[model samples]
Target: MGTVGITGDDGEFHLISMWVAPEARGTGVADLLLHAVLEHAGVGGGRIRLEVTEGNIAAERLYLRHGFRRTGVCGTVGGDRPEFEMVLDL
Candidate 1:
């Protein structure tokens, strides 16, 4: 299990910082977490958004499969890693 962020931003819900345990990979844990977040976003009439490192193709694919389209690119807050900003309409 991991933590997923659900916060209010400008009256909208935001989903972020979702991660799963290494041993839980491929066990649908991430999918379940994402679904829960999406459900919460829908209830709050907000879109779901997240950023992932460009090199994390697996995560990108998973987000895409869940209808999160790439919107833009964002720099890591304190690091040099490049991240892709994605959003899913609720």
Candidate 2:
């Protein structure tokens, strides 16, 4: 298992670091956790955002199915891997 963070910045919430346990993969755990996070953002009147590695096609598709649009690409903060920034309007 990993962790997720929803940070408030100037009254807007940003969703980050969403990951599922290896044993939970393909079990709809990611979708359920993402939906719950989005619901929480909605209740707070904020939007959700996250970054996924460019090579992660499955995650990209999952976010797309969840209504998260690709906003832009960004460099990883402390790593060499590139990432795509996605946002969900809640």
lDDT of 2 by residue, 38-66 (tens): 77778756577788887899899889999
Candidate with top lDDT is 1
Tell me the TM-score of each prediction against the true structure.
0.85, 0.82
lDDT of 1 by residue, 17-74 (tens): 8889998989899899888887767775657777888789989988998998988767
- Poorest 10 consecutive residues of model 2 by lDDT? 2-11
Models, CA RMSD each: 1.8, 2.0
Off by over 4 Å in 1: 9-11
* Runs with alpha carbons beyond 4 Å of true place in candidate 2: 1-3, 9-11
